[model samples]
Target chain A: MVTEEEIESVSKLVRIKVADHREHIEKVRDMINFFEMLDSAGVEDDELVMDDVPVSRLREDAHESFGGLSGYVREYRDGYVRVPKMD
Target chain B: MNHSSIIRASALEYVRGVTSGEFTAEEFLSETLSRIEEAEARYNAYLHVEDGQKLLARAREIDRGIKSGQKVGLLAGMPVSIKDNICMRGSRTTCGSRMLEGFVAPYDATAVSRLNAEGGIIVAKANMDEFAMGLTTEFSAYGPSRNPWNTGYVPGGSSGGSAVAAAAFECVASLGSDTGGSVRNPASFCSVVGYKPTYGLVSRHGLVSYANSIEQIGPIARTVSDAALVLGVIAGRDEHDDTTADATPATDYLEGIEGGVEGMRVGIVDEMTEGADPEVARAAERAAGNLEAAGASCERVSLDMVGYSVPSYYTITAAEAASNLARYDNLRYGYDLPLDGYEFNSYVAEARGRFGPEVTRRMILGGYVSSAGHAGRYYLKALKVRAKLTREVADAFASSYDILMAPTVPILPFRIGEKTDDPVSLFMVDLNTVTANLTRRPAVSVPYAVSAGGLPIGIQMMADSMQDRTLLRAARALEMRRPPLPEVPD
Candidate 1:
C-alpha cells in the first residue's frame, strides 16, 4: 500500500539518503502489507500498556559527571566533539 | 581430564573439574581456546576471542585461588561467551554492524561486571545480526555464523553465534539477548538451552538497545542447569539500570530446579503450532505427552491474540530502533570518514548509510509508521495489539495454566540463503518466542528432538512474570524426560 513517494519521504525522514528509494519501494511495500495485518487484530477497545513508574521509584534527578566519556568521541578537541559544518 | 571431557563438559562439570582438582582452570581454558579456533574455522561462531595469554592468566589466577582455599566465587573458572552487543569494558563490541566496529566499551555492563566478579572467564564475543535486527545471523555485516548442527544450514539468530559457540563447545555457556527470540531461536536450531527471563529480571544496562522494552539478556547453555547457573549470576537488581525488577541480587535459580512438574497445569498453545512442519508439531505433542507422563496435566489451549503478535512485534521494534539508533550520527564514535566540505545533513545521511539492509528497512518503516499521519493505523494500533496480547497470555496463566508450552519455532532449520529474501517467512520464526517478551514473562527453550535430517528442535515453556523459578523447574522436568539428543556433528 506504500508508494514510492512515501518510501522516499520515510528514508529522508530517517536521515538515510537513499538516492534511489524507488528500488526499495517494492520490498518496503511488502513489509508494510505484512504489518497491515494488525488492522484486523481485534483490539479496538484495548488501551496501550504503559510502564508507568511512580515518582518515588524514579531515581534522584542528580547528574554525576561520567569521566572519560568525551574520549569516546571520534573527533574531539578542547572538550567538544567536532562535527561537519552546520550549513 | 581428557580432551573430550574438557571440550564437551557442561559448565557445572567444568567448575567441578577445576575446583575438585580433576583439572586446572588453566588446562580447561587452554583446551577450550584451542577448540574455539577449530570451531570458528568450521562454524564462524565468534566475533572476537581474547588473546590466549590474557585468558590463561585469568584462569591461572582462579587455579591459585582454589589451591589457596580462598573464597573464589560461584562460577569457579567456567568459560562463557557474550553476545557482542553486551558491553565488556575495553572489548570491541561491534554489534555485528560496521557502524561500531572500532568502538571499545568504556565501562563494564552490570552483567559483565557481575560475571567477572563471580569468577567467570569471558572467553569470546559471539556474533549476532546487525543491531540485532534480523531473526537470522545472515544480516551480519561480517559473514553469517553457520550452524554447527549442519554447516550448510543456518543457526537461527540474532544470537546465532552464542548458540553455535555453546552447542559446539567453544564456551561452556554463553549469554545472548532475546529481543524477539534471538536467544531461543538459535538455541533451538543448535540444540541448546536458552532462557529469556521476565522483562526487567535481568539488567539491560550493558545491552545495545533494539527494542528496550522487550529485550533481555539471557543464557544459552548445553544443559538447563548450566543456563540456570549463569542466569543466577546475571539476573538481579542493578543501580545502573533502573528498569530492573525488585528482586534479590544473584537469586539462586537452581535451588528447586528438581522440584518436578508433578500436578502442574500445562497449556499447549494451539496457535503456536498450527500449520507447523509436521515433525515440529509432532514434537510439541510428544513434549506434552512426556510432561503428562511425568505427572503434569496437559491440554490444548487456544490463544487468539498470538495470531497478531509477529506483526505487532515488528512494528514496535522498528519504531524503537529508529529512535534508539538516532544516536549514531557519526558526530561521535563510528568508523573513520573524512569530514571536509560536507554539511551536517549530508554528513549524517552519508554516515548512516553504513547500516545493513535490514536495519535500513526497519528505520524507514519505523519512520513511516511513527509519523504523525500514519501513527493511528500503524504504530498505535500495534501497541494496542501488544496490550491485548499481554492480557490474553496473563489470563491464560491466571485461570488454568501453571505453564504454557509450544515448539520453539514452527519449522526446522533451512539452509542459509533459502529464506533471506522472504521477510514474512523470517518473522514467523519468532512465532512462539515473542509472546514471552511481549507479556513480560519468562520463557525457556529446551532442546527436545532432532529432525530426520539432523536439524535440532526445541520445546518452549513460558511462565507468568516473576515466576522464573517455576519456569526453570518445568524446563528441567521436560529436559529430564526427553529422548536422548545426538551430538552436534563435527
Candidate 2:
C-alpha cells in the first residue's frame, strides 16, 4: 500500500488536491496495482513510432494569430486580463 | 404528424417531413421540446436544454427557408443533442464537471459547425461522466442519467446522456465523444446505435479533451441510418484540425450503407466474449449466426494482445488527460475562486480542488506513471504494449477479416450505484470496447437483443481504420436480422 505522504507528494506534482486523501490513496493504489499487469505483457520498450504521419502530410508552416481576441477574455479589462484580486 | 410521432421520428424522417411540408420545423421543435420536458425529468439526460423559445425561433427560420425553397442543407432542422464536452458558441460546455460548470464556449467545434451548417438544430447539451472519465454516468457531477429501459439501472457512460436522449425520443440524434467506448457503452445500455469513427474521421478541434490520441466525435442515434446520416454531415477534412484525414474518405456515408454484407468475413474476437454473461455471450453467437445466414463467414479470431489492451489504453489516456486537462488552472477557463492570502501555486491548487474524484484519481495516477522514477515501469511499457496491440490488430485486419464482432458490453446494465465503488470492475466493463480505441479502428454498437429483465444488449462490430462504411453496412445487416426490439417504456 502506498503511504499517505506519497499520495500527497503525487498530488503536489500534479497540482491537484484530492479531498479524501486516504480514500484516494486506496483508489490510486488499486489503479497502480492494476497497472502492474503490464509487467507481464511481454512487451519491450521499443522505439516509439505510431499513428505516424509523414512530413509531407504536415500543413504549411504559416502561422496567423487570432486578432481582436480581447472580447473573448471574459474578464478582460481594457487590454489586460483580470486576475483574482490579491489580498 | 402528431406530437408523439413527431417526437419519435428518426433523423431522416424528421428531415423528410419538414422538407416535404408534412410538418413544419417549428411544429417538430415544439413536439420535441414537449417530449424533452416529459422525459428529461425521469432520465436526467440533458445537462442544459436550449431555450425553448430561442430554439423554436431558429426552427421557424428553417421552416421559412424550406417554404421559400432556400438552399436548405441536408438535415432540414433536425433536432440533435450534443454531449456537453463539445463546444457550441453560446452553450455551456460543462463536460459534466463542476470545475467547468459555468464556462460558456466562445467558439464552435468543427463537428458542431458542420451539423449547424447542415441545419441540425442543437436542442440540448447531454450529460456525461466528469471529464468523460467513468464507465457509468454515476460519476457525473450533476447526476446520473438513467437508462430509458429502466430508470433504476444505469445508462452506460460516459455518453450515457447522449444515448438516453436518443432512446427516449428527446432528440433525433446526439453527438458524443468516444474514448475507450464512451459512446458505444451507453448506446449498448440504452438500445441506441452509437458509432465511433476512425481517428481523424471527424475533427476534434473544439472537443474538451480528456484523451486526445484515442477520442473521436461520434453519433448516437435510434438506428444505423440516422447515425450514418449524421456521420456524413460532420465527417471529412477540416483545416482547423490537421489530424483530420487529408483525403477525406467519403462525405456521404449514408450513400451505399444499404449494401448488404453478403460474402463478407467477420472475426468474433475471443478475448472480447470469453468472460461475458451467458446471455450476453449467446447474443454475440446469435449475431454471428445472423451474419452467417447473410452469407458472411463468422469465426473466432484470438488476438492475445487484447488481454493487455485495457491497461495500455487506461495508461495512455491518463497521461494524455493529465496533459490535456492541465490548462484548467482556475485562471483562464474555470469557475470563479477567491485568491486572497495565497501564493500562485497554492491558489491554483485550491481552485483545482473542484475536480471530481474520478478526474483527480486519474491525474494522480498520470503524474506517478509519467514521473521520472516510474516512467520505465509504467508509461513506456504501456506504450510498447499499445504498439504491440496495434500491430496485432493490423495484422488481423490485413491477413484475415473484413469486420470484427463482439458483445458491446460484458454484462447488461447494472443498477446505478452497483459498480461505482469498484473501479477495476468498472474498467473491466470496457474490455470488449477498448481494443477499437487502442487500435484506432472504426467501431459501432447496434442494439441487438433485450435481456429477460428488459435490459438492452448491443452487438459491437468493428473494422480496420477508415473502414467505417463497411462497418456500418455490417451493423445494418445485423439490425435487419435481429428480433424486433421493445419500445422504451413510458
Provide the lDDT at B78 for model 1: 82
Q: Residue B185 error for model 2, in Å?
A: 0.4
- Please report the TM-score between candidate 1 and the true structure: 0.97
What C-alpha lDDT do the candidate models reach, one value each? 0.89, 0.89
lDDT of 1 by residue, B94-209 (tens): 99998996788877888999899999999999999999988779999888999988899999999999999999889999999999999999999999999999898899988999
RMSD of 1: 1.6
DockQ for the candidates, in order: 0.72, 0.52
Q: Work out the TM-score per prediction.
A: 0.97, 0.96
Clashes of each: 0, 0
Alpha carbon lDDT at A39, candidate 2: 89
